[model samples]
Every structure is written in C-alpha cells, then in structure tokens.
Target: MIHFEISSYNPVLLTNSPLNIGVVETTLDALGERLLVIDRRGKVITQRLVPANNKLAIIVPFEYTVNNNLMCILLDDDAEKDGELVDNVKAAVIDMKNYTPPV
Candidate 1:
C-alpha cells in the first residue's frame, strides 16, 4: 500500500470540493475518522462513520501503483486556433520527502 502522511497547515475540511480530496475506507474507529484517499482519476473513497465535519491528520493508502503521466485535454476551438495557453506549460517531476506522522 502507498502510505501518505498528510499535514494541513490550514483548517481545511475534507469535503467534496474543487480543492479537497476524498477518503477511501468505510470503517470508523474510536476517533470516528478514517483516511481520505483520492486517485489520479479523481475518485474519492472515505469511511462511512467519520462525520463529514471532523478534520485531522490522516493516512491514505493505495492498493495500486500511481501513474504520474500528465495528460492535458484542450478544447477543439483552442486547439484549432493555436491557443497560447498550452504553449506556456511544461511538465516535470520532482522528488518529495516522506512526512512522518506525529505521535
């Protein structure tokens, strides 16, 4: 499983939003929470009992490997007109350090 140690600097709720991702598991615990998981395809998985209001540190695990291939879909009009929006973009990969969860 792919483990992610998540830390939110701001008070952000893991809800269905443009900026927030979803959890994957459906089991609840004494803390009444579970990990929020999101895939590259934008699928959200979450625990059923974690109140939608509680926000805390979560560990997200994935059953499969992640594909980092970046794909961009442009509108037909933009593509035909040779829009400048796509010209300014470049894709690259950067190494990220694993964040250890606090005890």
Candidate 2:
C-alpha cells in the first residue's frame, strides 16, 4: 500500500490579470509513481509524473476561474495490474475570490 501525505494552501492568489496564479504546492511523500488530478465528474484534469523528491507544485492557468473541487490520486507503478487501496487525498478547493476583473 502506498501512503501519501498531502497538504495544500487555500485560495491561491492570482495578482497578475489574465496571467497564471501562484503555484499550488503539494507533497507526495515519495510514494506513488504518478499523480492524477481529477475533476468533480471523474475526469482527469491534469497529471504529474511523480519526481524523486516529495514536493510537487502545480501552476493554475489564467483560463481557470471557476471554483473547482479537484481530486488528487496517487497511483503506483503497477496500478493497472493490482488495485491497491492506497491513501485517498482530496486536493484543496480552488476558489479565486475577491478577484476584480479588468475594467
């Protein structure tokens, strides 16, 4: 079983208008071989190849402005063969509030 320690910050600030916001920081605890970010509808929003280090950061593009609840799942190398019940981590609900549109 792969165990992952995931933590995240809330409401990442996007100061630059029409630009990418601050990065979303996450730690995989050096467990899974890959990380998948899924949306509410079980859709794969993004995927990251887990690195050797435990730290992983994701950048939110300017196009995404809706408040979305994403699911971060860590899969082992042999995830397809053996369905191991590893740790289940829910990523932070990204809501960009207090963002004033350009006039």
Q: Which parts of model 1 have CA positions greater than 4 angstroms off? A: 1-37, 47-56, 64-100
lDDT of candidate 1 over 1-103, digit per residue (tens)? 9999877668868454332221121222334333333344655433222344433333333222134322222222323343111121122221113333222
Clashes of 1: 5
Error of 2 at 24 (Å): 2.6
Clashes of 2: 0
Model 2, residue 90: C-alpha shift (Å): 9.0
- Per lDDT, the best of the predicted structures is 2
**TM-scores for every predicted model:** 0.18, 0.48
